[model samples]
Target: MERGFRLILAASLMLMLLDLCRGSTIGVCYGRNADDLPTPDKAAQLVQQHNIKYVRIYDSNIQVFKAFANTGIELMIGIPNSDLLPFAQFQSNADSWLKNNILPYYPSTKITYITVGAEATEVNSTSLVVPAMQNVFTALRKAGLHKKIKVSTTHSLGVLSRSFPPSAGAFNSSFASFLKPLLIFLAENKSPFMVDIYPYYAFRDSPNNVSLDYALFESSSEVIDPNTGLLYTNMFDAQIDALYFALAALNFRTIKIMVTETGWPSKGSPKETAATPDNAQTYNTNLIRHVINDTGTPAKPGEELDVYIFSLFNENRKPGLDSERNWGLFYPDKTSVYNLDFSGRGSVDVITGANITNTNGTTWCIASSNASDRVLQSALDWACGPGNVDCSPIQPSQPCYEPDTLVSHASYAFNSFYQQNGASDVACSFGGLGVRVDKNPSYDKCLYMTTGSNKTLSTNATAIPTTSHSLAGKVHTSKSSWTFMISFLLFLAIDSIRGW
Candidate 1:
C-alpha cells in the first residue's frame, strides 16, 4: 500500500510537471506577402495583446522580426522560395543573409526556427527547396546557431499519397526521392516535419463526398482510420494521424510532426465557394478549443497535438484564388473578421473595416502561461516551436494511457501529494483572467480544483488572480532567514533535477 501510494503521488507530480511544460500560445503564420498590412510594430502590439508567443513567417522579414523584438514572442523564420537557388548556389550568401537578417535581431526577438520554404513539395519550385534547406543548415552550422535555431521546411498535404482512412496514408512516390533524405536529415538534426493541413479544402473539393458535420467538428458524424482500427471523429485529427501513420510506415516514428498551418478561409470566390466568416469562425474556434484544452486525437490519445492556425491576418495581395487571400481571422487592419466568444478568454468580433485593430487578451494568457516558466526551460521548448502538440477538443479517441504523473513527480523529487500540492488547481487556472480554457456552453462551472495548503483561494483566483502563483509554486524563499535558507538550499541542490 505504501508503494502504491508513492506511485500515485509520483504520477500526479509528473502530470503537473507535464502540464507545467505545455504552451497555450496559438502559433499563427504571419505572411507579409501583401503590402497592405499593419506595420510590424503595430502587428507586434496586436500579437502581444493576444499573448501569441509563436509566430511563423515567410522570408526573414526584418520589419516583421524587428516588430516582434523584445515583445517576448518566439519566431520561426523562413527563407523564401525565390531565395532558395541563390542560397543553395552561394554558401557565402547564406552566411551573409544570416548575419544581415537573422543575427542582428534574434536573442531579443526570439527567432526559434527557420522554415526553408512554405508548402515546398506541391509548389512549382519544389526541386530547389531541398538543396536550399541544406544551404541554410550549412549556413547555420557556420554561424554557430545551428543548435539554437532549428532548420525545417513546411509542406502542403498535397504531397500525401493517401490520407483517407488515415492508416492507409502514404507519401507520393514523386516525393520519396526528396522525402527519404529529408526524413534522415530531420531525424539526425532533431527537427520536426511541418505540414499545412486544411480539411476545408478537402470538403470544398468534394462536399458531396465528405460529411459537413465531421469537417465542422460537430460531434455527430464519426471517422475511422481503417488501417489502425482507430476512429477519427474529425477530419483535422484524421489528417494528422494520417501523416503519423504514413511516417511510421516509412520507418520513422520519432520524427515529430507539427501542423504548421491549418485554418479555414472566411471568404471565397464563386467557383471556389464554401468560404464564409461563420464557417471560418467555427473552424478556427473549434480548433482553438481543441488545442487549448490539451485534447488529443484517436491515434495519440492524451498527447497534446501542436498546431498553428494558417494566418494571423488576411493577405490582400496573395496571388491565388479568392480563398487563398481569405484564410484570416482578422482583416489587414487587425480587426477580427468574425464574432466569437472563447468562454471569456476575451471575445473576437469586429465590424468589417480597412484600418481596424483587434487585441486578444485571452489568447495571449493561454499562450504565455506555458511559456512563462523558468527562462532556461522556455529557452529550450521555445526553440523553433513547442512540444508541437496542441490537444484537440471533444475526445476524438479513447484516451491513451495517462502519462506517468507519479513517475514525473518522483523524477522531479516533488515532496507533495497532488491535492496537497494543488495540481488540479494549477490545471484549472487556465480559464478566465483573459486565459482561454475550453468550455461547453451548457455548464456554468468548468473543470476546477481544490487548493493545497488549505488556503482559501481568492474568489477570483482562477480568473483575474491576485498573483500568478496562487496554485503553482509561488514562494521561492525569503530574506532574514539566511542561515536556515542556506541549509535548505544546500539540501535541495543535490535533489533538484536541474542539478541532478
Candidate 2:
C-alpha cells in the first residue's frame, strides 16, 4: 500500500512539473520578402512588445541576428532552397555558412532550430533535403552547438497524397524513398518534422465539403472518423492528426511535429470572399489559443504542439493569388491588420477598415443568467482557486460584497480572470457559465478591471474602504509548490496510518 501510494505521488509530481516547465509554443514567422517592411531592429521591438517570445526568420540576416540579441526571444533561423545544393554538396560550405551566419550571434540570440530548406517536396528538390540537413548537423556538431540547435527542413501539405478522415492519412508513394530516409534522420537526431498547414486553402478549394466554422475553429458540430471513431471538432486538428497518422504509418510515431507556417489572410481579390478581416482574426486568434492551451489533436491529446503563425508582415512581392500576399498579422508599417491577442488569453473581433488601429473594446465577463447556482459556485471556486483570481474584493464587508449573491461573486471572479488573461473569450468561458457583455458591471463603490488601457472603472461617488489590488501583481501558485505541499501532507498521513 505504501509503495503504491508513493508511486501515485511520484506520477502526480512528474505531471505537475511537466505542466509548469512548458513554455509558450506559439511563434510568428518573420518573412521579409517586401521592400516596405520595417528594419529588423524595429520589427524585433514590435514583436517583443506584443509578448511574443518565439520568432522564425527565413534567413540569417546579420541585421536580424543583431537586433534580436539579448532580447531573450528564441529564434528558428532558416536556410533558403537556393543554398541547398551548395550546403549538401560540400561540408566546408555548410561550415563556412554557419561560421559566417550563426556562430557570432548564437547563445546571445537564442537561435534554436536551423531549417535547411522549405517546401522542398513542392520544389522537386526532395533529394537534397536529407543530405543538406546531415551536412548542417555535422557543421553544428563540429562547432559543439549541434545539441543546442536542431537541423531540419519544412514541407508543404502537398507531400501527403491522402488526408481524409484523418485516420487514413498517408504520404504519397512517389516520395517514400525521400521521406523514409528523412524520417529516420529526424527520429535519430530527435528533430521535429516541420510542416506548413493551411486550412484556409483546403476550405477555399472545396467550400461545399469543408465548413467555414470548422476551418476557423468555431464549429458547433463534430466530425467523427468512421474507422477510428475519433471525433474532430475543427479542421486544424484533423489536418494535424492526419499528419500524425501518416508519420505513425511510416513507423516514425516517436517523431514530433512542428507547424512551421500557418495563418489566414485579412484581404483578398474579388473571388476570395472568405479572406476577410473577420475570418483572419478568428482563425489566427483561435489558432493561438488552441496551440498555447496545449489542446493537442485527437490522436495526441495533451501533447505540447509548437506552432508558428505565418508571415509577420504582408509581402507585396509575394507572387500568386491576392490572398498569398495578405497572410501577415501586421502590415509593412508594423501596425496590426486586426486585433489579435498573441498572448493567447483573449479573443479578437472582426475589424472593417483600411489601415485601422487595433483596440481593445469595452468587454466584461459575467455569470450567465441561465446557468444554475451550483455551476456558478463551481466555476467561482475554480476561478478563485487554481485560476488564481483575486477574490478578496467580493468577500464580506468588501466593495463588491453587496447583494452577497453567488452569481454576483462569480461574475467578479470570472471577469478578474478574464481581464487578467487578455480579455479573451476563452478566459471568460467558465464551462459555459460565464457570458461576455459590453456594459460595465461596476456598481456603488465596487470597480471592475478592464484591459490594459483603462485599468478600472470609476464612479461619480467617493470610493469605499477597500484593499487595493493590481492585476499586474497577481500572484500565481506554482504547480511545483502545490505538488510539494500535497506530497508532504500525503507522507504525513501515510506515516500516521502506518503507526495506527
Question: All candidates' TM-scores?
Answer: 0.68, 0.72
True-structure lDDT of candidate 1: 0.60
Clashing pairs in 2: 346-424
Best by lDDT: 2
Highest-scoring model, TM-score = 2
Clashes of 2: 1
| lDDT digits (tens) for residues 316-346 of candidate 2 | 9989889989999899888889877654544
